[model samples]
Target: MFRDTQSSWMSTLRHDVPASLVVFLIAVPLSLGIAMASGAPLAAGLIAAVVGGVVAGALGGSAVQVSGPAAGLSLVVVDLVHTYGWRATCMITLLAGAVQLLLGVFKAARAALAVSPAVIHGMLAAVGVIIALAQLHVVLGGSPQKSAVANVLELPGQIADLHGPKVAIGILTITVLAVWTRLPRVFRAVPAPLAALAAAAGTAWAFGWDVTRVDLSGSFTEWGFPVLPQGDWHLIVASVLLVALLAGCESLLCSVAVDGMHGGRRVDLDQELTGQGVANMVAGALGGLPVAGVIVRSTANVQAGARTRWAAILHGVWVLVFAVGFGWSITLIPLEALAALLVFIGVQMVNLGHIRKVHGHGEVPVYVVTMAAVILLGLAEGVLAGLALAVLLALRRLTWVTVRKRDDRDGRTRVTISGSLTFLGVPRLTHELRTIPYGAAVDLDLNIDFMDNGAFEAIHSWRLDHERMGGTVVIDELHDEWYALAASGARTLPAKSPLKAPDRWWLPWAQRRRGAEPVTVPPDGVSECLVTAGTREYHRSTAPLVKPIFTELARKQQPSHLFITCADSRIMPSLITASGPGDLFTVRNIGNLVPRRGSEPHDDSVVAAIEYATQVLGVRTITVCGHSGCGAMAGVLSGGVRAGSLPGLRRWLRHGNHSLATFIETEGDRLHAGALDVLCRVNVQQQLENLRTYRKVDEQVREGKLELVGLFFDIGSARVHLVPPLRPTLCVKPFDRPVVAGEE
Candidate 1:
């Protein structure tokens, strides 16, 4: 068993490490030459190869992958160097590297893959052509050429004037190696390219081939080490940028591909990015060239049967040994061989079939990525462009809404919508409701809590449209949630959506204005699918049959007062006092606002909460409260409250109004304020006084038992506070006795 279990790991590792050695060997010469072509020191490209293996491998991503200076970058890096100078080019690289690191840290590594495939293919093909054109001089041993068919057209003239013996040696080397590479795999590792290098060097030695080699004597240390340029902040920055982007993109792509192949899911995209960012930072600091997750070596490892990320690490060992031990030998590899390798890599990326699949979904994504990748001349720009397009597409989808209609026993239409009602969806959703018919008794069922601020505002506008259509809209049922996004469903608007008023226009004005609830005659195909879904809250659950004081007060006449309180879902004034209709005028909100406090203009909600309660229902008592875990109390207790998050709520919470300034000062940081019980008492006391700001409310309270009182009801005990009576008048200890069903 030991032998068998160990056999698998040993056999796999042995094959993969050696195979990766071949891939790495292939990568080295290309790296050195590409760096030279890009107008950077040959060592810079070697740095990329070394860093690609060393840093990216140690960071632990993508098994069997390698990284190095890539030919794909030649045109862009070269042009940037020519235009901005090497130092500036390095700075750009540094900036690009930083961006890549950020993407990895943010787990945005996969964002690049979102590019439209057609655009990707088109860009890739364009890159292929660029690569082929740029390498023409080296392949044919001619001078530098420009891009396009024009340059290609002059190839005949260029070939006729080629560096005679160098051209001949290049031709002979290409031929013999081409034939040898075609031989069986075991023989292929005999290093035919190295043999060709020997043959070419021999020809140069035998015949005075005066073609220029790497012009090394211009700069070298006394110790014969290549002289690297002294660092400037600008150059270092550029190098960092280039390294970060190149590494991030290459690594993430390789990781994803490997994951797909083995089904060995290990890397978390975000964490992997974090790791890559750190890796690049280290690599850049050490003066290594930019490194990216290279796919070829990784794939070779996979082909050789790598089971772990370790294969990547091992490949780095081989690179270090070769770079240190064979520096002299490396200088002899022909520029043409490196170009051929790049051509091969470029060809592998054609992937036309993949493009067809991506094109099927839509073209916009492809369009965006294509333009970004090609136009911007760097992977970062293209990847970012692709990400932007994908996000826009997602937002559009969110805004594209669909609506469903359901009915309860009363035959009233419950319009349930599915999808985000974003501002984008507003015009469409608004128009759809116009067809609901006037005089329609529509219960706009916003059982969905999934609406963002934008969506909430959109639905709020619908209230105006509903009223304009001559229809009576009842915001009868709603969810208790406050910050409902489009994904969670919604709470119906009370007159003006969530947190408005119960009887906004008084029952009679609504009755006089539009009858018992206008009848809606569904326009075909709407009636049968009206299946009831979701639950209903009546705001009328009686245990000790605790009733609302408003209901008791409303029984006699239209009461114009609101009791803004906590969301306990109990402590009902209507049931506790047996008031009905317009008796005990009441308004309920988390925190009460009245008689504007602060430099801010008075909110309609404060005016409206009080106005509808006092002016509309003519409520005599305006009760404000803060109960256990009251979010508003927490705001005052914790210094520096964020009013923006809760919107209307933040404004209303200022009702602890004077408490934050006056009460807390006298009490000396002892915020009977943040504490639930203390907040409840403070809320009642503060609100009783604020209610006086409404002249009508003041007049009524002085007029008898209608007097405003402060109460602190303990939720644990289910006790009702009688305030000044200094007694828990409505205490129902569950342990003492089971609540007599429906007893008030």
Candidate 2:
């Protein structure tokens, strides 16, 4: 525990210190500016920023998110302050914090995610417009009007009679903030807002401009408590709820956005809400504005390499220290410069990137309506309008249907209906059904569910009318039997298993499509399985790809090599070698063992295949492939095949007696693990020697007419290992070969 603590502290010192400094620089200007725009004391913004960092950071769910005053809530705060005064507005903020705490306690924060993204973006855009309009007045050396409309109408006059020095300072601040990003790399480490404010301060001092500056009064010596409102109780309560919901929604949304920007830990929405609520309560009780998760500071913290929440907490400590010790330095910043900063931030809140994204999802109408209504009417009115449109669009998708009509080759009209069949889809279904010819045979397929009475009656009556005109109507259901159940007057039916597709293992790669219909399998009989495999491969998957290869193989076949292997069903010579038609002539037998040329018990099948491949086809190579887990080898080791159940069968296995003798001579009486596997490999070498008993095979090996190869396949590891020859006289590759089976 002690070691872990020391490591954590060292990590924080390395990463969090620099990030905290960057966030502190960003938070100072934004905190003061948002408070000024909201018609509150400048100190309130700083107080909220401090409380948000220290209190929320210590208990928040996100590891690196920085919390502070946000510009998106400026419109609401301004209206509340104007109606109830700053003291009463602080009381409303406190009440809202209580409500948020209750919501977090009940774990209701996840419900806020269901709100439409279009509506959320529209709300932020509306707030941005309001902030921009109001701060523009302040930048022009005039106070804002009562509402957004009043401020807009009076903006023309304020611009025409703009005060000279303050307007110049505001423009200088906006210019510096805009161009800071395009500056050289060295200048980027310093926060752009701090750089802009410093330039504004320097310019004002040099020119002796009489611009308004920040007023903190006595700082920490004069802290004020919140006062209760005297308005109607219900109205006050509703206002509190709105404030809490908006603040909670904005904070949770910022956390979600920040979660995507990092690869580390993810944020917990419930715990983050509780932290914001607790921070708001502390800030409001001390005469501060409402607090939220601010994206600007959070993004800056992430970019600056913060690894923990200690950065956010330390940033708050720095702000509080700066406010108490160096209060005079903050007072030197001109209010017009701060307002210019707010105007820039407000403009950015209406993001064009987000607008393009929502437009792609066909939610642009909801975004546009909400934004316009908020700007022209009010925030609540705009949000409600957007929400209503989102609900209507969702309902339209739930009952959507598609009806497709086609003419079949068998003199029938086919109609396929998909998606939910409800009352809303009846009109479209009826119109499509009437378009079919009256006396034509109909095959209707329903790949749908949820059939209502209105749709059922329309389809049933159409089918009956067509049948009465000397036409046959055949109905086939794919997904559900809704139409049949309703026609038979049965509300319920027994559940049946879904139909399984017939095996299509013979299809080649190019001939198969995913999810195709299965061909029917015939009953088991002598030639039934052969007919099924042959027909399915030719008609379904084979003929289209390589018909010429099969056509040429039909007349005369010439193969390069003869492959001899065990009769294990898992082994496929063509699949392993990647060889197509007329590549390898194959001979499969139990254990892949070869009998001597003049042995007492001779196998005519093996001798004849070797003669046909080598002498007739002029094959150059003969490969003997043995596999692990050979039942023949296991039976030889266990003496299971030596029983006298059948004399003919026992005589046939005499060729494998040499392999059993090798296993007993090399290995002792104790059979360890993998003893049978070791014997299976030695059996391949024994069989290769036995193949030379034929005078033709021995002469070909010396005359170079054929190359003899021995292969051992390990089924468990899916690898093929070459068996070394007992003597150096064999003509083959000198190196041991190990190949990953099935790999080309």
**Deviation (Å) of 5 in candidate 2:** 1.7
Supply candidate 1's per-residue lDDT for 11.
62
lDDT of each: 0.54, 0.82
* lDDT (tens digit, per residue) of candidate 2 on 1-744: 999999999999999988999999999888998899888889999999999999989887888889988887778888889889998998998889888888988999998888888898998998898888888998999987777799999999999998999999999999999999999989998899999999999999999999998777775567678899888998899889888888888888888888877767889899998998898898889988898898889999999999999999999999999887887898899999999998898898899988999999988988999898988888778888999998887776656778978775456677778667788989889999989887898888775656777888999999999889888888876546789988999773334223222235545433544322223333442333545645754553345447666865776788887888899876777765556678788999878888878886868999999889888998887778889888877767777554348666566667888887876777866687888788888788788788888888889988867777778888787667777654433556633445222122
TM-score for each candidate, following the candidate numbering = 0.48, 0.68
- Per-candidate alpha-carbon RMSD to the true structure: 23.3, 16.4
- Give the Å error, residue 152, model 2: 2.5
Runs with alpha carbons beyond 4 Å of true place in candidate 1: 1-16, 59-64, 70-76, 83-129, 137-239, 263-265, 268-288, 324-333, 360-388, 402-417, 430-744
Residue pairs of candidate 2 with colliding backbone atoms: none
Error of 1 at 67 (Å): 3.2
